[model samples]
Target: MDPRILDLFCFWLLLSSLLRLCSAISSASDHRYALGDLVPFYANKVGPFQNPSETYRYFDLPFCPPAHVTEKREDLGEILNGDRLVHAKYELNFRQDKPLQSLCKKTLSVEDVRIFRDAVRKDYYFQMYYDDLPVWGSVGEVVDSSGRVHDRRYFLYTCVHFEILYNEDRVIEIGVATNGETIDITEDKDVVVEFKYSVKWKETNKTFERRMDKYLQQSFLPQHVEIHWFSIMNSCVTVLLLTGFLTTILIRVLKNDFIKYSCDEEIADDFDESGWKYIHGDVFRFPPFKSLFCAVLGSGTQLFMLSIFIFMLAIIGVFYPYNRGALYSALVIIYVLTSGIAGYSAASFYKQMDGVYWVGNLILTGGLFCVPLFLTFCFLNTVAIGYKSTAALPFGTILMILLIWMLVTSPLLFLGGIAGRNSTADFQAPCRTNKFPREIPQLAWYRQTAPQMILAGFLPFSAIYIELYYIFASIWGHKVYTIYSILFIVFMILVISTAFVTIAFTYFQLSAEDHEWWWRSVLCGGSTGVFIFGYCFHYFFARSDMSGFMQTSFFFGYMTCVCYGFFLMLGTIGFKASLLFVRHMYQSIKCE
Candidate 1:
């Protein structure tokens, strides 16, 4: 091993140790499950409770068979108490045509408790609720003496169990002795008894996912219908108003400029006032830092398309709110599947820029985002492991993720890069570049990079601000967000807001005789992500009460990716919009 590499690893280990020590010493390392938290359970799924003809899907919850029918069942593991939405419910699979008997062999016990089928494993211990507090009671302790039930029965508060089967269709009774003791229902025959069971399940041998969306971490929401409307209408109005103003400016001002420049020669002198015509060539010249730009543009394009499709799936009811990490799993699968799109966009854009070194561009495009994601994941996982939290991915899962990236995604990217390199696009500009670079003149304060970025990002950020709050709360706080339709609408508005803001900023820059619009266009539109990160930082302190290093690391680690992806998506939108904006305006005139 290289000495420097070894040293670096040693240093990383030391840093990790220090961080864990600091987390331990910090005052906020509590990991206790809060009382009164709602314990969600999964209903046992059997062969088509409604229509016995149809096969069972994971989402299908089986209903109870008719009274007096006997059914044998298998356990989907016992339910357990967990933090947030960190746990999942396994479906209790029962033998076909099995039903609980109307009358079974009588027991000598005072009360016969239905033992929910489960042969326990160590991942999640069964958590039964007594007086709304979690206890490690098994299936036989069915009717605990605690009373949270009433005669009204507004909520059916217990997990539905299935009657399991033996190898033979024997008429064996579904009876479970209560370990040793029994609860006599006769003592409280008239009393209402409420019992609860929560499931924290996983696929057989599959471990728990380390981090889950905060909004989905719980199954509770305090939102009213009016608040949903408020979030949607606020964003819609912001986008509509900005769009209206831009439309008016374009129609009234640009219409006359186009007419005058096209027909009248004398008024054409005024067209040279700011000389947007002077740097038409430079404006369209290939942007510098070609590889990085292509990478950003490519990744952004893929994400843009992926987001639209994902939301479409959500709108169509593919991702349910309590579907237990289905959304995240789908996203990972999509990103891997879309690797080719990213590669194509990067290579094609780079080639169009007249950039050589296609291999370098491809490598950069692959690593630019993926590497950061891996590093952040490792950091968070390390923290989770240090804190002994269930939110840490085991070594096997991490290795599996790496294998997927390397074996599956990498080859797709290479194929895409090869295909895109063979494709060609011509750059159409009204003017030609001169041998010497144009000397740009100084501009007003608002036209400067900082001011332009702030203003350009402001409107777009405002458009999604309300939705963003909900999204963050869902990811970090205990909130359940299932409004996919509204989310899709807000996202479209945000895209429009970003494009218009970038186009406006680009126009101002060109008007000021500043030809540095390449990076400016990117920064202006991408700054919305910066503001988002800023808001997240503020939320960490102002809006959120989350504490502990493990939580903090997990929060920020994912936030970084979200912010970066946003930057790419919006920056690509701005860059492309500016190109079209310049082409439409300059090409309309006889600048050549």
Candidate 2:
């Protein structure tokens, strides 16, 4: 092994660690509180009942079975509060056309109560309300005539009794309420009913409150939307820049060196027994090069694109914790859409390896598309049925996904197959075989086996593992999106670590005389996921913070993407590095 390469690697790790530490320190300087105080204090609010007409119903819910609700049947887990509601509850109706005071004579049914319950449960988190004002609540005991104590709902309220009823038997109803006000029914009819609850930002310590007019005016402007658009555009530009740089490097390196080396014939003289000749043809006869190429190239592109998408969305508030399923959806969609990139990468590598078999290439390309979809169904089918997780692909959507893969990706893969089969690739390995055989060096405890080398790659990577864990935790635990800096750090770590590990592994493989360069790339490159899985396992036991269901989903869903991305990145790094090493070895040793 070159001491220079190893020292350079050690220095790289140190520098990366220092940069990350500096970034963390800079972020901490902006903090407003002590370590314990950094956790956000949330202000609980009750009702806005903001706009009831546009509320989502069961039938329209994503991924839900088409069903109509009449008399609401409470599924124990599905409905939040069951026994608290008074059955056949009172309802009131008002017409925007008629003044609220004039149209107050409306009767109510079970349906109106159901609508109110669903709206409150689905949209808001407040547990207590009085005449529509949110209040802090306490549990108290009330004695029934039977002399048994029952739970009573106690909330601070100015109103004595609240009645709800429905009028005109409308399918949907909207209402509003103002601060502790009772309607004087029987005069005007145009006033829409509204309920208002004022909340303060828990983080803001001051008592100042914005005027209602100003708040309303500010909320209507979509300034945040424009910010999100700009963030995505910036991310796309970054990806293009990185891609162009990598492309230029790849092309230049390929042009400069072209030979691949397996074993030096001169080195054979150093062996104790000439019987070692049995290890010749089989020496460089590594696994199918196409598979390795496909995995790496596909993954590199996927990682690059995914990091851009995630960070961009993070910047835009789309990947924020509250956006349920957005992260998972992003991951699934990226992989599905990147099939073309994967097929093309795999095909190119296979061509470089001088491998043939168009039928095999076609089958392999199609399989990558099907595998993830199958796994997704295994994990999400139940959730899809339960929440109608509305995000899961509908039948039509799934069919469309398959059609795109078949029609669009499959053809490109076929073309790649033809190109790969017909293409002539030169092997530069015999040059290394003829060159003065340098003594094969021994690896330390770290770089010998596939597992050890993989773990070694995780050394620099785990320095930022804390931030990664926090990001994953926030996603699982439903935290807000305020921690954008941490996300960017995570993005940088994944990219840098992938590149470093690939370079390191290629160096190690070359040192160990395992010059079956292409397959070695996949092995060393794919090893990073093993370390990621280890970290995930540690998180599983260490963090007792997530719900069982969420924990399960996060673990599997996260593992799926991590493993997929790790292998993909490894393959890419491994292949390119291996190609470069082979070329370097060949150019150095080839006879004139």
Best by lDDT: 1
Question: Which stretches in model 2 have alpha-carbon errors above 4 Å?
Answer: 1-296, 299-337, 386-393, 415-424, 427-447, 480-490, 516-518, 549-554, 589-592
lDDT of 2: 0.41
Q: After superposition, how far is residue 323 of candidate 1 from its true place, in Å?
A: 1.3
Identify the candidate with maximal TM-score: 1
Model 2, span 389-413: residue lDDT tens: 3223346545654654555445545
Q: 466-545 in candidate 1: lDDT tens per residue?
A: 77877877666435677777788888888988998898778778866788788889898899999998889988888876
lDDT of each: 0.59, 0.41
Q: What is the TM-score of each candidate against the true structure?
A: 0.66, 0.51
The lowest-lDDT stretch of 10 consecutive residues in candidate 2 is 77-86
Report how far off residue 472 is in candidate 1 (Å): 1.6
